[model samples]
Each structure stands twice: as C-alpha cells, then as structure tokens.
Target: MMRFILSLVLLPTLAAAQTPAADQARAAADALEAASNMLDDADGARDRVRALTETIQAFESGLGAMRTGLRQAAINEAQLTKKLQSREEEVAALLGALQSMGGGASPVALLHPDGPMGTARAGMLLAELTPALNARADALRTDLENVQTLRALQTDAAKRLQEGLTEVQAARIALNQAMANRTDLPKRFTADPVRTGILIASTETLDGFASGLSEIVTDEIEPAPVNLDGQIGELRLPVQGLILRRAGEADAAGVKRPGVIMATRPGAIVISPTAATIRYAGPLLDFGNVVILEPQADTLFVLAGLDVVYGEAGQVIAGGTPVGLMGGSLAEKGDELSPLREGTGTERSETLYIEVRQANRPQDPVAWFRTDEDG
Candidate 1:
C-alpha cells in the first residue's frame, strides 16, 4: 500500500520521461499504425480531415483531464500539508512525554504497574509499536517530497501549454488554408502520364532527364518578357515564403552551398518570375520534383520541393506563369513532411529550395528577389 502511494506521486514524472526523442519514435510508429488502421476505415481526403479533427478533439479532452488532475493534486497537497503538520506535533509531544516519564529505564513497568506478566506483554507490544511510529514519521517526509514534485510538474505543464496554445491555433488555421488554396488552384495543363512515368523511372540524373525533355520541342510555348540584364534585385519571388537561408551559407550537414531555402506555406503557387524556358521539371535525388528555368542564355533558375509540376522542358513559360504547387501536408509525392505532420510554423517546416546560376556558377538569389520583412 505504501509503494502504491509512492507510485501515484511518481506518475507525472514517469509519464514525462518519454521525451521529444521518444515522441519522434512514437509518432513514426503511430503514423504507420494510423495509415494501416485508416486504410480500412477511411475513403478519401475528407475522411482524413475528419480523422485528424477527431484526433485533435480527443487530445483536447485529454487536456481537460490533465487540468482536472492538476486541480486535485493542488488540493491534495494543501490538505496533506495541514494534516502532516498536526501529526508531526503530535508525534513530537508523544516522544517528549515518553522521555519525561522515564520510558528509557523500564518502559513496560511505566505503562503497566499491574503485574510482572502484564509489564512483559506491554514491553513486547511497545517494541512493535515503536517501529510503526517511525514508519509513519518517514512516510510524512516522503509525502512532502511528493507534494513538491507534483507542484513542479503543474508549473511546467502550464508554461508548455501556454506556449503550445498559440502554435496549435496557427497550425490548424494554416493547414486548413492550404487545403482551401489547393482546391482553388486552376488546372492549366495535364501532364502526359506515360512520358512522365518513364522519365522518372529511367533517368538516373536530373541533367539526363532534362536533356530528354529539351528534345521534345514544341512551337506552342511562349517566351517570358523578363529582361535578364540589369534586373538584379527587381524580380518578384517565385513563391510566397520566408527566406530562412541565403546563398553560400552552411546547411545542417555543414556544407557551404549556393542557393536559398524558404519556409513556405503548403499548396503555395509556384510561378516563373520571368520569361524562361523550362530545362527540367521532374524529380531528382532528394530534391523531390524539381523545375529548372533559363531566363537568358547564361542564367538558370532552379526550383525544387514542388508537389506537382505544370510545365515541360523546352517550353517557354512566360513571367508569372504557374509552374507548380508547393508540397503540403496532404501532398501525394511521398515528401518528408508526411508521416510527421507539419510542425509549429518553424522547425520541421515545408521548405522550398531555390538556386540561381550564371554560366554554371553559383550566385546569391537574395539580390534577385524581393525580401519580406515577416521572414
């Protein structure tokens, strides 16, 4: 029974032992589990939306339970403090009385002045009761420790919960908005399935696939009017996002690379910022679906991390032409952000990587596009 009480007090800390690392592992497993479970129970995107919404509601309910538990813990701590204080005084008074009454000399005789057998029996009983009193006193100290631990947990929870509330609101709103934007995107062109599939499957390098696309020349495509000469710092960004990276900066892998990485919204419209000919519009290595555009004879612009590509290589796409859509939470191309849902606006975000090259040399893209203050 004593062990059980200690376990109850340790419950909060034990639960928190599953750190962010544990959460990542659990989330991966849960995603697989959810996918398997949802296969039979779900039908389409709407079903997924409903499932996600339901999960959120369930989490909210758990939050309510946590709040209730915290309230009870606070009340229990206060009450226990009061009870233990009085009990401590009582124990001290009893000990003082025992000492003054000469319990040290002949405890049995002092308690029972009746007969020899009575004193012996009382002595044996007092020996057993002494340990019991000590045990009770030790339990009081343990209870105080438990109370302190519980209060700390509650304090941590409130701080984390307060920070997370703003994030939750922002995430849900962004996700829903992305879904809506995806629905609103106008279907301009339909890709040739057989050609795209063969291209993605057969080509080992992006350059090789781009060369193949360039071979399929058509006269229907129109050239963009953007003048590549003296247009530095005058071009609009190809997509809406926060520029998190600049050219020549080191990435997490510690490699000094050319190009910029933007944290973008899901389902964001990707456009060609100038009159350019498509050099590539397909997947390559870890870049997901990529699109390379050549606005001038010596300049090339690279756009990657798209969910869908709308233009073809050798096709002259005009300035502001919709080239693709940003990959989102519901993106079908097996992107990273999948399995792990979109993060809280910053870390583990949907990123678009862009590059600008002149004569095959890396150049800073920041000078070419307008920078936003929000980033």
Candidate 2:
C-alpha cells in the first residue's frame, strides 16, 4: 500500500514535467514557423534586387560579346587590307597611265608595251588581279558593316541598362513605402511624465529598469494588449537583422548580460514589440542612444546602441509602432532618400542591444520574448 502511494506521487510529478516540455516544444515550433515567414518576406525583397542584378549582368555580357565581335571585325579588316594593298596600288597606277592617254584612249593602248609579247603578258596579269581585287574590296566592306553592327548593339545595351537602373530605384522606394504602411498597432497606454522620469532613472540597468517600473503609473484605457505574455514563440522582431549575441553570452568585456545583440541596416526603423509607454528616450552611457520601453505592467524592455533615436520620454508607443529611426546613415539629404543595397547577409551597418526584465530582475529575453529571427 505504501509503494502504491509513492507511485501515485511520482505519476503527478512526471505528468507536470511532461506538460512544460510539451509547452516548450510548441513554443519552439511556433518560433520556427514565424522565422520561416520572415524569411519568405525577405526573399520577396531580395527577388526584386536580384532581378535588377540579372538585367545588368545580361547587359554587361552582351556588351562584352559586342566588344569581342568588334575586335574580330578589326582583325578581318586588317587581313583584307593586307591582301588588297598591292591591288590598290596597281589599280591607281593603271588609272593614271590611262588618264595620261586621254579619256578617249582604247583598252589596247593602255596595255601597250615594248612588244606584242609584253602587251599579251600585261593583259593576262590584269585579268588575274581584277577578280582578286574585287573579292578583297567586298570582304573589307563586310568587315566594316560587322563593326558598325557591333557598335550599335553595345550602345543599345548601355541605354537599356540605364533605364533598368531607374526602375530598380523606383522598386526600392516602393518597397520602403510598403514596409512603412504595415505598422498599424493601436496605442493602449498613456505615458505620464511623473512615471516616465522615475522609470528613466531606474532604467539605467536591466535589474533597476524592471523593479522600478511602478515609479510611474501608466493609465490603460482599451487594454488592447498584444498579449505578449501568452504569445510564447510568436513575437515579431523589433528590427530585421542577424543576432550576433544572445543572453548570458559574455561580451568583449567578459560581462554576461541578459540581452541579445543584433546587426541591422543603416537607418533601419526600430519598432515597439508590444503596446507600451516610453520610459526613456535619449543617450545613455556606452550605448550611444537608448530607448527604454515598458511593455508589460511588471516588465521593462531596454533597447540601446542606437546612432539616433526618435520619440520622446513619456510617449505612448503601440506595438509594431515605429518608435524611432536608427542612426548610421538614414542620414537624410534635403528631399532624397539614399538607396539601400541588397543584403547578402554580410552587410550590417549598426548594432542594436535588446534586453527584457520582469519585476526588476534580468530574464533571458530569448526564452521569455521569442522572435522569428535568430536572436
């Protein structure tokens, strides 16, 4: 009977362990699915860029072929010229001799020599050289025509390539605009100044940021929560980038922290993960520029290592909202936006540091807040 009771106790303990393992497995599967979706979206953009590249490469290849054709035409022209040089000189002298005899002179007079035998020899030589001179002249003309055709092909390719480049730029603009149109999350919390200040002071470290969030009370009206608490592995990344560092990973300074480091594009737009109040928005020590956000009542999210930031302290930012623009080169010119190069997964212009804390204690963001991306 005692053994039976022990078995019963062990059965509940085993069942509890299995339940968490199953939840974690489901979370991991969801994360993978999300990541696949993100990759698919990225591929769509890459296809556009790839099309532009293919057009250019084909144009370049055509130009190269044309150049080769032209070179070959030059070689043909040179060979034809060599074969006909003597014929050209002979014809010139023959015409001069005939001119001296007058336009009314007979063909026999032009061939007049010291004797009948010499005259016969001259006529025979002219007969043989005539056909060869005619053939060489035709060959030289064909070579010139080929060279001209090649030149025209090269010019046409260059013109088409320029037009294609213009289209590529237009596509890039359209893509950026389309991406901009996607953020439509509704704001749920109002940022109050009194709370924002205390949050900022307490936000210096991950621990302090989490524990001191209640210093400023947030007013929630609609409570349009993204429900980040239950989302498990279905969280959207604040930015598209490769994860360079993960939570608990030692930094170059050998300090282990609860955050992930991401490599992003120049002038990338930073978005809020969930509807929340901006606890702080300004520069911080060693972080370049920092934007602290409070996503949950007891949770604080810290984003640092920005070149520039947008929005201000005490601002209510919605989930998927563009909180700020990253620094690096979104450095805008008067009215023109610079083009973004195609990502080969090697070109990262800026690094963003992300951290999550609940109730004033650092937690592994990778485990709590899941993203579709590597981080």
TM-score quality measure for candidate 1: 0.41
lDDT of 1 by residue, 225-283 (tens): 44676777888788766787787788889866578988875555567888787776877
The best candidate by lDDT is 1
lDDT of all the models against the reference? 0.57, 0.53
- Lowest-scoring 10 consecutive residues by lDDT in candidate 1? 333-342
Q: Each candidate's TM vs. the true structure?
A: 0.41, 0.44
Candidate 2 per-residue lDDT over residues 177-287, each given as its tens digit = 543444443444556766656665556654664455455456655443435656645666676567888988898999987788888755555677777777677776457
Clashes of each: 1, 3
